[model samples]
Target: MITFWMQMRRTIRLLWSLFKDAETRGIAGVTTVLLLSGTLFYAHVEHFTYLDALYFSFTTLTTIGYGDIYPVTAVGKIFTMAYSVIGLGVMGSFLAVVVKKISQFDRRR
Candidate 1:
């Protein structure tokens, strides 16, 4: 029973590590897509689609709110605030990791 438990623990740790790596990559990709889509949305602010609106929200929350597109409604403002609070931390952390990786790469060069 003890040996079985030890094996299970090792397996769990391996699974957790894999999950963490995947989560970090997922966050980074999501952040980049949101930024790109947001920029596109801003460029075509008027008569935008639902996809454009979502893109705008993500970009704005990430603190890259290009003045090219802005919310004109009170509800939109409230939503923006909420989105920013939730999305900023994830985006910021992902950005920090990216920068750190880049700097490390530069050091090796």
Candidate 2:
């Protein structure tokens, strides 16, 4: 448990450091916009609460698809497909930035 906590701390520190970088911040901002837009769309179109919409957006973007929640309407379904494609690309870029930052951190260490 102690080791897990230590690792969590280290990860948090690394993420904080990454956020300090301009490139990382830019990509992260774009990712945030994508997530928020998706959340709003889900909330308005699917009648999901804000929290549920945010949860669905994150899971969909990450390709987790837990199946606890899903779209029933045709418009929702179509929007989801398009959203997934765009979200995945944005997420990929965000992750790539993180990985690059991590590599730089490793090298500095």
For TM-score, the strongest prediction is 2
Q: After superposition, how far is residue 24 of candidate 2 from its true place, in Å?
A: 0.9
Cα RMSD (angstroms) for every candidate in the order listed = 12.4, 2.2
Judging by lDDT against the true structure, name the best candidate: 2
Q: Which ten residues in a row have the lowest lDDT in candidate 2?
A: 100-109
lDDT of 1 by residue, 1-109 (tens): 9999987886676545544676567876786676565545444544456677766766576577677666776655665566577578867777676566546544755
Q: Residue 38 CA error for candidate 2 (Å)? A: 0.9
TM-score of each: 0.48, 0.87
- What local distance difference test score does each model get? 0.64, 0.93
lDDT of 2: 0.93
- TM-score of predicted structure 2: 0.87
